[model samples]
Target chain A: MTVNGVEQVRDIEPRLLLVHLLRDELRLTGTHWGCDTSNCGACTVWMDGLPVKSCTVLAVMADGRSVRTVEDLEGPFGLDQVQQSFMDCHGLQCGFCTPGMLMTARKLLDDNPDPTDTEIREAISGQICRCTGYRNIVAAIRHAADAEAAGRGDT
Target chain B: MQVPAFFEYQRATSVAHVVTLLERFGPEARIVAGGHSLIPMMKLRLAQPELLVDVNDLHELAGITVEDGVLRIGALTRHAELLASPLAGEHFPILHDAERVIADPVVRNRGTIGGSVCQADPSEDLSGVFTALRAVAVVRGVDGDRTVPMREFFHGPYETAVRPAEILVELRVPLQPGAGSAYVKVDRRVGDWAVAAAGAVVSLGPGGVVEQVGIGLTAVGDADFTAVEAEDLLRGRVADEYTFAAAGEAAATHCRPVADQRGPVDYKRHLAGELTVRALRDATARAHRGGSTE
Candidate 1:
């Protein structure tokens, strides 16, 4: 499997989850491993361009697939637009759910550049933020959309 | 962190390879699609298959097509794909209705309709929706293929009529002319497991009379996840409040629902009736509008 555009191959147990493989083996700690159950979006990542809860997906299932985690949010230029928006809008409080929220938000904005509030909420419904800070998280996503639009204007 | 128990894993390259593996592993082996349902259950130590066969790579078993007025959905077709399919939404609105609330979008990205049906969870909404739609299950085995009606496909909770070596490969829903369908579910929270859900398909005849009606209920029935008596009462009757209310009463009287954290028996029964009534009303109105919700 390729992690953030880097091919990673390892002999792992069939029972290992993608979250554990990414955090424990590959040391990509940006992808938080919270709530082993699929209820929390904390382990959310892009599996072939679609958001999937890594806690429920077996590492073996990711074979020959591309997995983009929150660690990929930054480029050579620094933080991605979505990450910058989160910082600008204070989308994080406890910061436990930030990684998953960022990943999911990036995908959401990529799919729908101008998603309504309802669409944004629906997109992140799988994730659980213990801090219950959904208001700013949603604002952060909107901010990202605005930034992208502004960036397009500049170009 | 929760993880599956020790098991041998094999990624099947083709349908023949899967059938051969099923033949070799027998019932102890489990065919994993998206693993949203099975993986969670496995981590809880509730279901531990000795061998796991991953069919995620079989792109052949993942598509949606409508031919000859029959909608064919592949087994590996993800819930997200089904929700986005214009073909599915056009022919069967009930599928879109259920898929929209099956789970959050992330989970839907991985959950497969085949796994939902094959799991045969009584609380599963798609089972009832499919049952109401009178869909057919295409099961492929070592010998050949066989089609089973969706209603008869489920034997009991967590059980199906799928043979040991047979895998459900596709679902065929016959598109009914002049038929409009709708599904309504009341879960505790957004995208949670449904407390009670109902699917209704109604076809209006000349003079706005009820030509035919189908009712499928979830989280209420014991083995058969449908309200046949309710459907019988609505079909051929006038599409009015009186007949709709009577149909609701029939559904509430027939199903055996138990009280749990979701709701009590009486409450679920009441929802079964009320949702049935609402679904019937919407379905009839949609049918009158020619089954297009654009």
Candidate 2:
């Protein structure tokens, strides 16, 4: 599979999970694994173009697909606007759920550049953030949307 | 920490190939699509298949289309797809209503309709919705293809009529013009399983008389997931609050619910009846609005 625009090949057990493959094998520790069940979205990653809980997905299911993890958020210039917004808006307290939140937020902005607050909440509803009570997380997403719109001269 | 037991995996490129692989591996082998349910079961040791056949590559089994007054939903259709399908929502609002609460958005992206229905969990929302729609399941085996009514699809909890050697490829729901349908559920959380849910499809004849009605209950343990007695009572009767309440009472009295972590027996039974009435009310309103559920 092409992970973060880089093709990777390895022989892995059929029962291995995609999150473990990314963390243990590829050493992409940016994606946190939480609540091995599909409930918590700390292990959220993009398969093809949609976000999915990595724990519930088998490694083999991603054999020929493209996976985008949180580690790929940075560009040649600097941190992506979503990451910047999270920091500016205090989106994380313990930072355990930050990766998953950032990944979901980035996708939401990509899909609907100017999403409403309700849409932002719905996009990240699958993920859990015990710290910050999700108020700042929602604010961070809204900030990112506003920043992106301003950069594009739409504000 | 949760990992499935060691098993051999094979990716089937075609539907015919999947059938061949199932036959080759025998009863202990399992076909996985989406793997949202089966993998969790495997990790918990509830299911331990020796061989896992991956059917994610079978593009033939991934689509939603309407043909000849029937809505054909490929078994591989994802819950997200169903929710986003305007055609499906226009034809059956019950489907859209059920899909909204099936699970969170991320999980919905990977969960397939076939997997959810095939899992046959008693609390599954789609099962009850399909039962209310009276849909048909198309099962393919080594010999040929056979269709099974949704009413007879479930033998029990986690047990389906699809034999070990066969694979469910598609679901077909015969379109009912001028009919309105809705699903009502009450879960503890946003994406939790329904404590007790109801799905209703209602059509009215001349003079505001009920022409047809189907009621399906979930989690409350209605045998076959249907309220046949309520349906029988509603047909040919005037669609009103009193009749709806009577149908709800019949459904609640007939269904058998057991106490579990979600609720007590009496509470679940009450939800069954109350949700039935609410669903029927919406369905009746939609029918009166010319079957346009906007």
Candidate 3:
């Protein structure tokens, strides 16, 4: 499986979930595993550029697919604009749901960079965050949009 | 941690290979496409298959097209794809409305329309929607292909007419000209299973009278989950408040719902009537002219 821009081939069981493949074998712990069921979006990752719960997906399904996890969002220079916006808007409180939020949020910005507050909520409706309410997450997504728009202006 | 029982996973490249694999493995083998439904069932120990034929790589069966005045949807079409397809939205708003709330977008990315239809759960939204539209399921076996009407497709909860060694390949919905359809589900929250849902397709004739109609309810048990008696009354009658009310009462009387967590028998029955009326009204209005997409 090619994950986070690296191709790591290994023999694994068919029942092995993509979440375990990343956390155990690849040691890419940035993607947290929560709610073994597909209910919680904490295990979300970009499969073929779309957000899908890794816990529900088998590792073999990702054999030839390019998977982009939250780890890939970090640039060599610093945090990506969406990741930075989360910190700036204080999108995290308990931090358990941050990785999934970040990954889903990045995809939202990629598809609809200037999503409205309602659109952001609808996009992350699958995710559950107990500590920090969704108000800040919506703000964080908006912050990323503003930053991206400002970046485009500078160029 | 939840994990499926030990099983051999074989990937099938084409529908023919899948048929061959089904014959090879017998009834103990099951096809795994999106794995959204089967995997969870496996983890919960509800379903244990000796072998799984992974059909995710079968690109041929993954298609959605409308031709010959019929919307032909390949069994492998993903929920996200169905929801995003403008052609589907233009033709059947019921599908789009139900898809939006079937599950979260993350799950929709992998869940197939075939998986939802084949699940055959009584509370499943698509079943009611398809039933109202009078859609048909195409089942392919080693012999040949057979079409089963939606009314006869579902045998019982979690059971369909698709026999062993036969796979549901496609769903065909005959296009309704000068007609509009709508689905209304009243769930406790979005993405949750329906507490009680209703869908209706109405076509008006001269003098704003309902020429044809199909009504279906979910979570509230009725014969075939359809308000056939109600549709009978509504057809050839002016689709006004009085007729709609009468039809709703007929629907409420026909369904036999059971008490559960979402609501009691009485409440669900009430929703069956209420939603039926609401769906009928919206569908009739849209048949005249498009209204709010939602």
Whole-model lDDT for model 2 versus the true structure?
Answer: 0.93
First chain of model 1: TM-score? 0.97
lDDT of 3 by residue, A11-84 (tens): 99988899999999899999999999998899999988889999999888788888999989989989999889
Per-residue lDDT of candidate 1, residues B74-166 (tens digit): 999999999999999988888899999998999999999999999998899999999899899999999999999998999999999898788
- Where model 2 places Cα greater than 4 Å from the true spot, the runs are none
Residue B251 C-alpha lDDT in model 2:
90
Answer with 1 or 3, whichever has the higher TM-score: 1
Candidate 1's TM-score reads 0.99
Off by over 4 Å in 3: B290-294
What RMSD, rounded to one decimal, does every model reach? 1.1, 0.9, 1.6
| CAPRI tier of model 2 | high
Instruction: List the lowest-lDDT window of 10 residues for candidate 3 chain B.
Output: B285-294
* Residue B288, model 1: Cα distance from true site in angstroms: 0.6
Separate clash counts for every candidate:
0, 0, 0
Residues A1-155, model 1: lDDT tens digits: 89999999999999999999999999999999999888889999999999999999999999999999998989999999999999999999999999999989999988899889999999999999999999999999989998998888943
